[model samples]
Target chain A: MRRDRIATDSGRDVTVVSRNGAASARDAAAFSTRWSYARKRQLFLGALAAPALVYVLAVAVGPMVQGFLYSFDNYNLIRPGSRHFVGLDNYIALWRDPTARSAVINTFLFTFGAVTIEFVLGLGVALLMWRDDWFNRIALGLLLVPATVTPLVVGLVFKALLNPEYGMIGYALAESGLSGPRGLLAEPQRALATLVAIDAWEWTPLMALILLAGLKSLPIDILEAAAVDGATAPQRFRLVILPLLMPAAFLALILRMMDAFRVFDIIFVSTSGGPADATNTLMIYGVKQGLEFFNIGAASAVSTVIVVCILIMAAAFIAVLKPARNRHA
Target chain B: MPDRARLSLLARRFAICVVLVIALAPVVWLFSIAYKPTSDIFASPPTLLFSPTWDNFSSVFRYFNLGRLLESSLIIAIGSTALSLLIGVPAGYALARSTSPRAIWLAYFFLIIRTVPPIATLIPFYLLMRDIGLLGTWWAVIILNTALNSAFVVWMMFAFFRAAPASIEEAAMTDGCTDFGAFIQVALPTVVPGLIASAIFCVMFSWNDFLYAMFLTKADTKTISVALLSAYGTKDISWGTLGALAHFSTLPIVVMMIALNRYFVQGLTQGVH
Candidate 1:
């Protein structure tokens, strides 16, 4: 039933149950390497890739698939399996409803607006920090603070600072020529925008760090050549820098966009998508319907749609990233 | 290389200093609120200078019981990170050593998983955790985080271990190391940096998480992230406790990141590349 083949430190033993009868696979890989390059590399890579694969299937794919399928059935968590096939029922409900539409739009708006601002701000900051200098110490320390704090705290902190009556934001705004007690999230129109700004403050550093690394790795010759050609600063930035920075910028955009669409913690704490559902993103709606309302089928539908959207986005990124991956391969 | 370069560098550094101030203003304001006397919190000009006191800090620690919440957070953080590594390392190793096409799909699936929103199965996961008798317990959050973040660990560490030399394991094997033994005795010790990086990230995600912790947990099982939020985000909140806990909540991460800046930045950049 068991092979007591290996022991670790602390005397904890690991059973080596040989799958397909190759001990460690390295021997097989070694044998193949001498005779067949492809076989050896594949085996070597396969071994390296297997753990991540298992994790994806077990924790990720299983739920995503089940969640998708559950959409087709009117499966309620409270009442497990009454099992009626709703053909496009949830889809119709979501599309036909205005509230759902607002949430979906808000989700995309949050993603696009927040990530755009963050990318610009991040690039500006990263460019400022590109050269080695004294700013490195304080800048690194300061910029890194926002991303390091837990999101929930960020939400609460912003909630306090932005609250009217006593919050500092109200006092500051009054000092600035604005009227009294503007609900950053209390007003229906400004609620989503307010949440978007919070995300920008929190995550712009991510964009900066990525761009800074990319900038660090750029070949200096091109920039020097541009300067020698008597290129102006803006001209050099627009032509030489922007094109080269596309890869990292696009990568940050994709990442930030993905994260922004899933805005939950801050919205949950700050506005709860309030003042007429202006700030409610899909995640919040999913939580409200699925968790609070116990409508698993509708939630499943939302989950399925989200998966499709993510897949589409990921497919585009894969195309973007494919060249780099192939070069590495 | 000359005065012009020096000037540009100085200008660049000044700009960076401004950006740094902008980035850190919100967090610094938290401390300002924490240390300022209640009467001085919202003075007309907004007092930037004040005598610091322990009243707020003491209240946060004692009355708010941030200490207990910190304990809860530490346990869950360590538990999730450990469990993630435990499952992830072996799984990553298996992928690296195996010759299966399934590995490709598995790795891609992990990537896809990483991209998908966390709320996709919030209700179902809650129901499942509840079904399994794990709802509202500390283990519930630990297991949830482990499951959620283990894929990231496996993927990142897989690349690390895959790049590892197989000869050490081969030499160990011929000299009486078993399959698992060759890995542990000969391989794992050298991969500590990767493991440490992945562990830090795992801790970061599990600790930073608010949604799952908020939705799946009760008061006793609540983490410091929740504590931090409740102080600032709720209707019953006050500025004094919010600032104090904010200091404590952020200090650990800031210290860790500063100590491991290179590793932290490198890990972050790797996600893009």
Candidate 2:
């Protein structure tokens, strides 16, 4: 009888038999109309999302996946016919190859060094610029000019300035005998550090901006309550402010870390991973292998390693931050 | 003011001045070089006081085909920005308004896409472009840039739209506006700042990008960023030519940044949330 009633829902208007049956049919009809309305909405939303989804999957993900696959093969563009599967040889060779090994280590050093200095300096700048004033506002706008200039150009600017023979700073430093016999970039010991300084110069303002945003977003009353509770300025900053600023700090650090790990343009133009490969980084190595040497297999391997390292680092950040976030929540 | 407070304020201002000088000096030096004569550009002491000349600027324009490089850059930046906004803004709206449990996750997925290292995609993309016969064309760079930029736009606009009120769109729907009409007429107007911010970001990133432009473009299609590299690598290491080219490469973006910084700050703050 229930099955017959359900089947009759399709043609209930024509097949109304009793008052109870007619009432059931009316409810079913209403539910069906509502269901169709939701379905239509879902369809409309899905239509809107489809283009981007397709494009990303096709253009971005497709190449990345192919690159990953290429890592597992003896892929060489120059000798395309010679290509074949080579399981973990490329990965193994990265460890065996001294240049590749240095690239990985140098990338870590660069990421950590640049991000650390940027964060520290950025936080200081943010604190100084915290007050809503015209001076700070204009200063911030001017400060961001270096960050706006292409990183490639920033490297060139420094390269020109740091030329020991003709550069203003470099010539002075060389003449004073403050730097090594060679200029800053020419000295392997000083090159990476110099690069870090350059990176900080380019990126620290942006960091400050992000941290400033976070600082501004903190609730004023909460801060005042902390102050009224007899917290000193330093105590308040350490206890109340630092905790609140973590999310923005995390964003800043992660963004910087990701970019710094792939420090290409600056290092490429400045040193080209030279001074005895002191500044060799993953990106510089990968580009040299893939583009310059046409060693696709080795290049793809480095690329894969980089992606893996980034994922691991990102995961580590989330894991570290997750507990604090949960506690706050 | 009290002496102690006055002292602190002066010290703070002094420190800020120091920071500003450090930040602006390198850029100032680069800009100043564009006006310096060739001989003075390579001056051993790097003399500060020299008669300015437009010779370097004229030489860069004459030799490097400055007009063509800037045109390519403008087209690539504007092209990618326009295309990405077109595809991304609507999708961002849909994601923002959707009722599905997975909508937020999809938005984050787009955010993560922006972090994918260029190396991971560059090689295969090179081959893909070559196979498609678009290897050296602006379209090749545009296509790759659009993919990345549109994903960013999607994520950014998602945040913008979510922050925008849904009540107005619902009211529009109740007032007989179609769903698309509500989005276009009522909802879109509220996110104009977001649109501008996203456009600015796209232009800046695509404009500053040298790697993709370097790898994908032929001589005629190279961007100013790429040209900046070749200028540095010239046989004579023409600092004057580089300085002049740097003006083209960095000035427009810098100017845009200063002009639109308010939107940048607003957009960044909103997006991070």
Candidate 3:
């Protein structure tokens, strides 16, 4: 009778109905069998997810909350006994702090400079390698080398190459009449620009790869239609391809911008934010405060600021890009 | 016009060649320096032609105990990858199956964790590990890396599992398999490629980590990256040895990239998509 009811409800052939009805009924029965069974499935799925949730809570979220609280306290690792609540003094000090202000400015400059150049160059390369050919494939493979090398190691390699006297790059640049004696990294005026170049080199391939994927998956019919309308390659690319590529481009921008804002490993090994703080981005400033100065409260405040800045950037990107995403859907 | 188009194509190819050379030159120079004899490393204009020496490799191993550092790095990376997979795969599967608003929020929570700078977490993590007396241990780095990598793992595998059809697991359940059994037996096999890709990524992230390893570990548990930084700091600059050590540290990941090129590209592109 239940099978008949299912067959009638589903409105299928009788033979097919019997098989599916049994299967569907079995599934329903499985869920219906003791509340314990339904609850068991829920428990099992929840249990499966529990470990990651617990781990994230313990490690990521817990540290963030603790860091926020620490920002309000005058806690120094070295002088643990002197720890006391300061309540926004650290944040207030940030307004007057020259070094902190410089770090924030430098971070913005680096993020914008690096990500912008990376996107432009990455798009160029992606377009160059748009065709699927042996040469392009090989080029793409070789490109991954820089992107895969550890950032710390990349910093060391560049530092060695830029070592003023005997360094390959510094020697070449000096011989070419490019800047003064201390080399690019040491020159206060040029240090940040050089760092931006290094960052662009390291990450542009990632941008290219992401964009290439976007280009590959672009609607061929649309491009061909544009071409059929007597559009030149450049016109077609500008009119059709660029708009289609915006979502990927924006995604690449967001990822690279967040990373650029948090840039540390390279700067740490190469400049250590010097040539007299010329390269002291926010991460470097925060690390210097917490680790070198042992001023936990100030470092936490810097961290809070960095987090807030990242959130603002992310929100802005989402706000701008979400509509494009929705329209496509 | 056809001639002009062909000329443009040639120009594009030439430009790409220049870009590739620029991209690969520094790495090639590092390798060249690593293989050169010590005296040749300081030679004016840097000699490209020389009898390569294993002395740098031997010296690094002798002076730095490269084996122990490699061991520490491997232990931490593998431990983190394993733990991440253990915790993250199930969560990914759950996220894939779930349609609840809570699940959507949970996904955002994972994304936010990944997006936040690691340094922001480092202060509290450093203090927390110090207070718990876990600082400078393999366990400390391992746990921290697990925390970092698991978020990524969950994010990557969440997409993977979502893309996979749910019908197989449903069929398995109809065949009298328990919910857990269906997941283990049916769903897991289907996403093996994704599992491998995510594992490779987790290992790379952990192995390449510098900030956490720098802050968390001391002498006994120091990873290769920290060791490389210290080698740079020693009084007499051994360019050859530094290059050799850098090469040694990067070799595993380089090999992985080459071997798993397809999967790596897929994983990266898929994440963005």
- In order, candidate lDDTs are 0.74, 0.87, 0.85
Q: lDDT by residue for model 3 over A109-165, one digit each (tens)?
A: 999999999999999999999999888887888888888888998998898788766
Higher-lDDT candidate of 1 and 2: 2
lDDT of 3 at A45: 73
* Candidate 1 lDDT over residue span B1-273, tens digit each: 899988988788777767777777777787778887766665554556788877777777665776678888899999989988887777766665554546645655555666688767566677677888888888878866777678877767666776677777777866876666777777888777778888889988988887788878888888888777656545444577678777777678867876776667767776566
The weakest ten consecutive residues by lDDT in model 1 chain B span: B229-238
Per-residue lDDT for A1-329 in model 1, tens only?
00111113112211222443445355445444434643544455455445545655655566667777767777676777676889789888988878889889988998898988998888988888777655475566567778887787788778767766556675576556463456566778777888888999999888888898888877799999999999999999999999988877776778677677777888888888887989888888877878778888888888777778877887777677766556556
- Off by more than 4 A, model 2: A1-32, A316-329, B1-7
**Who is ahead in DockQ, 1 or 3?**
3
TM-score of each: 0.85, 0.93, 0.91
I-RMSD for candidate 3: 4.0
What digit string (tens of lDDT, one per residue) describes model 2 on residues B78-197? 999999999899889889888786886788678767878888888999999999899999999999999999999998999899889888887888899987889899999999999999
Q: How would you encode candidate 2's per-residue C-alpha lDDT over A130-159 as one tens digit per residue?
A: 878888888888988888899888889999
- Clash-forming residue pairs, model 2: none
The stretch of ten residues in a row with the least summed lDDT in candidate 3 chain B is B99-108
Best by TM-score: 2
Estimate candidate 1's RMSD in Å: 7.9
TM-score of chain B of each: 0.89, 0.95, 0.92
